[model samples]
Target chain A: MARDRRGGSPPPTAVSTDLTRRARIRDAGLRLFSERGTEGATVRDIARAASVSPGLVRHHFGSKEGLRAACDAFVLERGTEIKERALFQGELDQPELLLMHRYLARSMVEGSGAAASMFDRLVQATQLWLERHAPSETPDPRGRAALLIAMELGALVMREVLSRALGSDTLSPEGSLRVARAKLELYSQPLLSADAAARARAAMDALGERLDAAAAGEGRPATGAGDPGG
Target chain B: MARDRRGGSPPPTAVSTDLTRRARIRDAGLRLFSERGTEGATVRDIARAASVSPGLVRHHFGSKEGLRAACDAFVLERGTEIKERALFQGELDQPELLLMHRYLARSMVEGSGAAASMFDRLVQATQLWLERHAPSETPDPRGRAALLIAMELGALVMREVLSRALGSDTLSPEGSLRVARAKLELYSQPLLSADAAARARAAMDALGERLDAAAAGEGRPATGAGDPGG
Candidate 1:
C-alpha cells in the first residue's frame, strides 16, 4: 500500500474501529452529561444517543460510572489544553481574556459530570501556571490563586445574576471582561500594606495550627476531612 | 357560633380552606423549584408532590408559570427576611455571617427559577439598606453594592467548584465563611487608594455613556435591553 502522507502507518481496522466506537460513546456521553447531570443520564440513554449497543458500552467502559470517569478525563484534558494554551502567552489582551472567561463560565454552568472535574483540573493548572510565571514572595500564592479563581468563576457562573443585580448585562463577554479586569486590577493592589499582609498571614497560620491540633485531638484529619457537617 | 379564644371570630371554612390550599401549593412549588429549575418541573409534578389535584393547581395558580411566580415571590420573601434579620444586629458574628453566606449560596445555586429575580430584588434591597445605614461618599454606593453582591454570590455558587479547585471543602458553612471573611476583609480595605477607584469609576462611566449613546443610535435601549447574545 502507498505510504500515508500524514506520516505514521494507519492502525489495524479492528483497533481503529474500536477507538472510533469508544470515542463516539465518550463524546455522546460528554454532551448529555454536560446538558443533564451524570445522575440524570442512564447508560441506555447514552448508548442510544451514541448509536452503539449497550453491550459495547459495557465492554469498553465497564459501567456507567466508569464511562463517566472516562468522559471526565477526556473533557478535562481538552479543556486544560485550551486554557493552558490561552494563558501560555503570559499577558492577555481583551479578546484572550474574554475567551478565558467564556470557556470557564461554560464549564462552570455545565457543571455536572465531567465539567466539575474539568473545573478542578483547570484550577490546578492555573495555580501551577501562576506560581511559575507570577511567583509572589509577599502575597501567598495559594491564597492568591483561590481569590483569583473565585473572582473569575464568580464573573462567569453568576453573569446573568450579576447583570440583573448590577442593572447591566455584566455577563456579556465584553462587559464581563471589562468589569473583571478592573476588579482584578483593583484587587491585585495590596489591600493590606505588605507588613499587614505578613501579619495577617502569621495570624492565620497560628489559627490554622490550632485548628489542626483541635482536629487531631478529635481524632480527625486537620484539613477538615472528618467534618460531616459540610 | 361558639366564641374562639384566639380571635374575635373564626375565618369562614371556604376562605381558610382556600388559604390553606394555596399556601400548601405555594410551599410545595417553592421546594420543587428550588431543587430543580422552573422548566424542569411541571404542574402535574408539583400538584402530585403537593398532594393536591391537578385541577386545584390550575384553579389556584392559573398555570405552571403562575405557580412558579408565586413560588419565586414566596422564597424571595423568606430569604430576604432571614438576610435582613441577620444583618439587622449591626455587626455580624461568625455564626451570623455563616448564616448569611449559606442563605445567599442557596439562592445563587437555586438561580434558574425565581432565585434569579430574587437576586435582583435582594440587590435593590441591599443597596437601599446600605444607603440608609452605611452611606458612603467616596466609593459609589451603587457600585459598591454591586461589587459586594458579586463577591458574595461568587463565594456561594462557586464554593463547591472553589473547594475542588483549592483542594478543600470550601462549601463547608464554617470553613467557607472563615475564608470568605478573611478575603472580604482584605478586599474591603481599599484595593486602590481613593484615587484609583475614582479613576476606574470614571473610565467605566465614560464607557457606559458611549455604549448608551451607541445603543440609542441603534434605536435600542442603552443597558443592553435588545441584545439577544446574552
Candidate 2:
C-alpha cells in the first residue's frame, strides 16, 4: 500500500533517491518563495520550478506550510555552513566574507517571515558558538555573543551607509567588500585576541553584578547607600 | 513686504520667538509624521497637534515637504545631542544609553523617509567625529568612521535582537537597559582604552596600504612581479 502511494515505485528502499528528491523540492521552493513570496507562489509553481509533479510535492510535504518550513531550515543551514567554513577552515578571505555579508544584507531587508526567522537562527547560532568556545569561566556569554554578532553584521551594512554618507561609491560590490575587509581587520584584531575576549567577558560580568545590586537596592532608602560620602 | 505678511505681530525682531515657533512646528510635525507617516498626516493635523493655526504651519514650513524635511533635521539633531552628551558628560549611564537606543530602534524600523534621512545624517556625524578624534596618522578616516558608527548603531539594535533570540524581554524598559549596559561594558572597556584605539588606527592604515597595492595590480596580467616565487 505504501509503495502504491508512491506511484508504484520500488518498495521504498531507495533512501538516497528520496533524500535527493526532497532536497530538490526544498531548493525549488526557496527560489519560488523568494521570488514571489509564500502566498503568491502556488504548489504547482513550486513543482514546476523543481521539475517534479505536484504529487511529489504533496508526497514529500503535506502542504505549503510544511514546504515553507523546510525552506526556512535550508536557509538556516546555509548560514551555519558559512559560519563553520569561516571558523574551521582557516581565515575567511575577503571574497568569502563578502559573500556572507551580501547574503546577510539581502536577508536583513527581505521583510519575509522566512528571512526574519533565518536571522533569528543566525543569532541563536552565535549564542551557541559562544557557549561552546568561550572560556569556561566566561560570564555573560549571551551578552558577549550578542556583541560579536552585532559587530559582524554591523560591518556589513555600515559599509553601504558610510559610502553614501562620504559621497563615494565605495559601496559598489568590489569597493564595499574592500571597505568591509578593512573594517573587519580593524575590529577583529582586538576582538579575536584571546586576552581581549577574556577581558571583555570579565567586564560584562562585573557590569551585571553592579546592575543586580542596583536593582536590589531599589527598596532601600537611597539617601545613605547612594551617597558618595557613605 | 515680508513684515506686512505678519498678522499684526511685532516686526519679528525677536529671534527667540521665531526659534521657539519654528521648534514647536517641527516637534508637532515629527510626532504626527511618526504616527501617521508623511502622506497620511496633513498640515492641518500637524497644526492641530501643535495647537497652532494652519496658516502658521505654512508660515513655518512652505509645504508638507518642507515640514517633513524639518522633522528629519530635528531627529538628526536629537541623535547628535545624545552622542554629544554620552561622549562628554562622563560615562553614559545605563538609562541614558537605553533612552537613546530605544529612540534609535524605533527610528530604524519606522520605514519613513524622515527615519532614513535621519540615519544618514547620524552616519555623517560619526564620520566627522572619527576624523577629529582618531589618531592623526590614521588613514581612511571615512572607512574607520563608518565602522565606528556601524558598531554604535549595531550595538543598539543587537540588544533587541539578542533579547528576542534568547527569549528574554531584554527590550523592556529596565531589562533592555540592563542588557545594554552589559554589552556596552564589554565593548567599551577595550574601545575606550587609548592603547587599543591607537593600535586599531595603525592597523587600519596598514590595511589601507595593502588594499591600495592590491587594487593597483588589478589590471596587470599575471607576470614575474606578481608571482611569489619570482
Which DockQ values do the candidates obtain, in the order shown? 0.16, 0.14
lDDT for each of the candidates? 0.54, 0.52
* Cα error, candidate 1, residue B146 (Å): 2.6
Q: Model 2 over residues A12-110: C-alpha lDDT tens digits?
A: 456434445667787678666654445557999888877678998988888888887776666566656765665576344434344444444433433
| Candidate 2 residue lDDT tens string, B1-230 | 12323343545455433445567677677666544445557898888776668898888788888887666665566656765676666444545444444444434433345555656665566656544433333345555555566565554444435455546665453454445444544433332235544554465456556656767886422110000000
| DockQ category of candidate 2 | incorrect
User: Model 1 residue A213 lDDT?
Assistant: 69
TM-score of each: 0.55, 0.53
Candidate 2 at residue B71, lDDT?
63
Candidate 1 TM-score over all chains jointly: 0.55
The deviation in Å at residue A207 for candidate 2 is 7.9
All models, RMSD in angstroms: 10.4, 11.2
Q: Which ten residues in a row have the lowest lDDT in candidate 2 chain A?
A: A221-230
